[model samples]
Target: MKIAVIDAQGAGLGKTVIKKIRKEIGLNIHITALGTNPTATSNMLKAGANHGLTGENSICNFCNTNSLDSIIGPIGIICSGGIKGEITSSISQSVFNLNCTKYIIPMQKHGIYIPGTINLKIKNIIEEIVSDIKKNIEKLS
Candidate 1:
């Protein structure tokens, strides 16, 4: 399946997700890393993304008007001036408005106070996404 993994900044999370998927599913999957910066895209590329694109314009061109099979990322990717504020509003709108299946990683946006950590349950969120992907692929096949 063609999967688009969108991240505004720091592809560490994307890298982790890609690694887990590779470990769990041995099939060759198509991964598109959409990042706001080159570093983020490069990291995901190293993690096994088949292709990578950076910047708001590039991402918009890659994803706009196309109902992708799946989009995996945090809600921030759909929001303007958030985590990776560099993600242009147009790109965010395209992703949010497109008629595509989205796998939003769970994030606790409330009642959390950490000095230097996001405190998000990233592993659990990734697991949920992976499980869903497995089920969908199985049903489709």
Candidate 2:
């Protein structure tokens, strides 16, 4: 299965998510790191993503043409001018329009909050994400 992990700015969250996915999901799945900047892309690549793409155009083009099974990222990815303005409207629109399952991490930094996720930690959230991805892969298999 092919999955894209999107992130912006420092990409600290992306890197951690990639690492967990790699460690828990193994290497069978293809991971694409879609970053808003080169640094973010580089960091996620180092975390073991099979492929990496940087910038708004690259990310949008990739999402447009690729048949991704899932897209995982902070909820801000869908908001224009999010991630400290690194996420553009075009990028957000492309991701939002993708015909794939989306796993959005509710981040407080984005100033958007989900009612039930208030007490959830980032690590726990990512663990849940990995588990869900595993289930999806199993279903496809």
Best prediction by lDDT: 2
TM-score of each: 0.85, 0.97
Candidate 1 residue 68 Cα shift, in angstroms, is 1.8
Identify the runs in model 1 with alpha carbons over 4 angstroms from their true place: 65-67, 108-120
Over 59-80, each residue of candidate 2 has an lDDT whose tens digit, in order, gives 9999999999999999999999
Best by TM-score: 2
- True-vs-predicted CA distance for residue 36, candidate 1, Å: 0.8
Off by over 4 Å in 2: none
46-116, model 1: which lDDT tens digit per residue?
88888899988888888875557788877667667656366568877878876768886655542324453
Which 10 residues in a row give candidate 2 its minimum summed lDDT? 108-117
Q: TM-score of predicted model 1?
A: 0.85
Could you tally the backbone clashes for each prediction?
0, 0
What clash pairs does model 1 have? none
